[model samples]
Target: MWELRHRGGGGPGPGGEAASPPREGEAAGGDHETESTSDKETDIDDRYGDLDSRTDSDIPEIPPSLDRTPEILKKALSGLSSRWKNWWIRGILTLTMISLFFLIIYMGSFMLMLLVLSIQVKCFHEIITIGYRVYHSYDLPWFRTLSWYFLLCVNYFFYGETVADYFATFVQREEQLQFLIRYHRFISFALYLAGFCMFVLSLVKKHYRLQFYMFAWTHVTLLITVTQSHLVIQNLFEGMIWFLVPISSVICNDITAYIFGFFFGRTPLIKLSPKKTWEGFIGGFFSTVIFGFIAAYVLSKYQYFVCPVEYRSDVNSFVTECEPSELFQLQSYSLPPFLKAVLRRETVSMYPFQIHSIALSTFASLIGPFGGFFASGFKRAFKIKDFANTIPGHGGIMDRFDCQYLMATFVHVYITSFIRGPNPSKVLQQLLVLQPEQQLNIYKTLKTHLTEKGILQPTLKV
Candidate 1:
């Protein structure tokens, strides 16, 4: 009994000399010859018990359960295999989501901004939840609170910038908002500093590493969800078509790829996403390019869809009306000789946006899936089948939007690179924010330049 106690108690050896702790390379042992092994392990456990207990958080092994068919559908399609059942569930939900999306679009730009915010919040929650689950840091003080606090700080910063940039006229009328907008970055930074100080104050000794890990995790999540969602809203303000075409291309690719893969997939595309295939990837690329071209053509014809969302101070509301940009205006393009010979046409008139859509569609098809695959690998790392069970068949909102976020970033980059040019409206918005003296100086400078160019009649000084 004393021997048992000695072995288990992690105490000194029978010899007065203390037992050396087991080497890091050696494993736990059983034989009496190595009786000290168990004692050494016990000593190590005692030394780091607090961390070991929390760090051992492993998700239990469970089979993938992506089916998640709703009860009514399950009962109705009870005869079908799980694969077909999932197909039905996903298809119905996809259409429902698209319909709801159109409804939001009809409700107008404010509603679309709200939708982006909602998705951003949900995605942030899903990712933060995963971090919490992986770390099992429930005992860590103020972590969940800090995560949410940082999220609010980020939203305030991004949305504040959006209002300042896109709603300058509207903001100018509100005194309280004017102050906030004037010093938006400083306020955002102060808010973040408060969160950072709270985090430092909340740190516990044993959980220091884990706490810092969660800190980094929260910031990375904000970068992914908040930053990309802001870019999406920026795309929306460019024109509804700017927002819609890229997103629709991704959706088109995701669906067509899945459908093609379901029917014809053989060679695996990537180890990260086992089900993705070369056949589906190729099919999705062609389908998305076609879909983007057609959608751009259709949307470009409508002033409402093609116009930038702008604040109309006269109407005291936001509006989407302006002369369509060169992008939306139809232009003639000369076909290459071979294409001209094949099609029997020398030139084709098309919206410049339709030509740009080909690039957007190509990225959505070829590169967008990598975003989804990255999410899949993240889940695999954590032994999770899904981010959350929010959507019946879609896993979570993040699952559906992973590729969309990637597409949004790409579109924003593409616009700045190729599509967007100097905007008179944006410059006017900046002028509106200036003091009267500054505005007058700019006006004088502009008038003088215009007079020199003979575009404006010069006023004689009295």
Candidate 2:
């Protein structure tokens, strides 16, 4: 669309004399023959004059090379494919890295929790640092300090609640922990109050708005990171499925989407994620659900993958059991009309939990990616390319797990609503930690209730 008709003059202008200098907002009028006839230095000066004539500040800037996907990957490959410039090499390398990440996660329950914690810390840092950078613009006092202090308070409150709920026995067996177990809420409130008072004291003239903005920013970051991560740990207590299934599903969907987009992408999915395409989104969804079912089936048969982490003092080590819930147990369900006709069977058997996995995968594909979209919007708002380039081509840890925290929340809620039951084992473990008086009282109460319901043994009734 651009035309460069102007060049060094061969002869003249409209008057057939020497050409005049171009006025402002006008393209130069000239010819090339005179420029070639003259020295090369004169031609270079004329070219510089053309460049200086126009205002280029209004032109849109190309984003930094480092921020672009191709450049990031090329650097990550250490300039591999420098000649042929194969960009897909980076995608393959990323896949290899992700495969290794899951391998470490599969090794143990502690490793899974460790992974979650690591992601949480990195995500929190990314968000808070963004807020901190903006805070200085407002000249706010103690904003960084207050934000981190609130983070600590919130984490303490959440972790305390988690331990008291999930590890009641652990808390009850220790006197110091018993006190915390009794008054955890009051202690948490006190810590929060301390931070609140500090914020109030730190407030300066005409800076209330900035302080409030930072307060909300810190809280939102905590919600996105600490709160959801705590739920992931709680899911671990239920079983690994609540943690593993959704995470794997999301990762699968992301990978499949990228591959699909790479090959067949045309229509954009959204402005926030410009590289995302309709082909990728649809492909990732179907693939995620199918993978969800298969993974559920495979992981269901394994004790370590299916069982909750529990203490085993007799063996002096933590262990998992193979007694899966009825949800995880295989059951027969009548097949659909087409499926039944194709298979020539009345029913096909599968873990009922696998059906639930379809729901998990649905959320992972459809809703979980919104978390990443939100992160994209956040970065755009700040004019940042990535949160940080912690990974070679992948941006940051937060960038990788933006969808994961949302997926973790969904899995936790799904388990609580559908799969979890009144756990008799957890209740018994709790009962074992009570004083003898309390334990006897509970026993009597249980016995009388059972007798009234006609469930007591005749020999023991007397």
Candidate 3:
């Protein structure tokens, strides 16, 4: 076995440095030594050990100093904290948006109804211009102004009666013509003829194709407005419900979309609207259904106000006094046996008011969102960020009213088709059958009798 010698100080003969050679019995000790040459250099006591022995006081000592933070670093950290504190700002923004939304709904309810009518008129005018553009390839100076006046007349002719009837007492005597000739009919015809002449004249100007298109577009627009207007008016959906359904549906859809988008919106639904997601669509769909049900329930409860019930007593009395002309229409009409018996008993109840809530909801959900989608597509097509930045975090009039337009038309159609009972003539016949005029006379007679007997107060109408 090799032996190893321990080298503490100078042991080598050549340079007086430590270099102990391995001995036969110490070879295992050399193998076990793991310290490298670099470790030996870093050991501080190696050189000092060769010097004369020194006391502990011979070395100088240094004390530790405090660490100082930079002012710029402190400011940077503060800024990061402030930037992250956005909760309060977000809350304030949300509240403001909600308040403005309700305010718009309140004022816009009536304004939107007017807007719908106006859009129809304007769209009609645009269509006429489209025709002129197609046929003549350019606009006539007076065409716009003339179209406005023409559309106004047509609107007044169709809508004036129903709108005036809403506030019947405010209506002037001259506005009460139900069956009078429409004075603007000739002007309307003349405008159409003039447009035709303009189209023909364009042929002389080498723009016949454009002029033909202009006339064609004008007529097409006119037809569209006429059809839509007829549908809306005939349905008798001009009241507050017109505003409520659309507004409610849009609001509900928006809210539900937000809720779902916030929670589960991991994937985008469409590239055009990146924020829209499958989660949001599902949420909106369910929310729309809920709103529909609520609207139906509320409308049903208030059906009496929307559509009043007319009661009839004593069929014999009604028939005896009803006009011969009215009797012809009443011939096929008869009340249920039970209801007739109840009417004969002079009961107050005859017809219970009914409202179609489910129908209203179905229409709102199906048609309302299409309006929104179309508006979205329109914005995408135009390459616009939004309609306008009028409402913070929201968009413009077109953006807000998109869904409303479709919803209004849908509910109006539903009400017209199913909710409104039979014709007015039938109702009038039933009222006449009760001998309303005779009953009024008898009532007046009783009133006089009661006054003479000191049982009632007498009053005179001016």
How do the predictions measure up, each by TM-score? Answer: 0.86, 0.78, 0.47
Candidate 3 per-residue lDDT over residues 1-462, each given as its tens digit: 011122243365777766764433355434434444333542333432322233334332222222222344345445455433233333344576567655644563334345556656555643453344322334444455545554555555556444333322222223433223223355456655665564455353323333344445455555456546544433333334444544566667766776687678888876657767888877777777777556644543433223322222323110112221211121233557797787774333211211244455545555566666776765554345455444333444445555655555576665557555455643333333346687687679979999999899879779
RMSD list, candidates in order? 6.9, 14.9, 32.8
- Cα TM-score of candidate 2: 0.78
Count of steric clashes across candidates, in order: 0, 1, 26
Question: Runs in model 3 with CA error above 4 Å?
Answer: 1-143, 146-150, 161-239, 267-275, 298-356, 385-393, 421-462
User: 120-230 in candidate 1: lDDT tens per residue?
Assistant: 999999999888866676788999999999999998998887777777767778999888888889999999999999999998766676788889999999999999999
The lDDT of each candidate is 0.85, 0.76, 0.48
Global local distance difference test of model 1: 0.85
Candidate 1 segments whose C-alpha is farther than 4 A from its true place? 1-68, 422-435
Lowest summed lDDT over 10 consecutive residues: which window, candidate 2?
A: 56-65
Candidate with top lDDT is 1
Given candidate 3, what's the lDDT at residue 373? 73
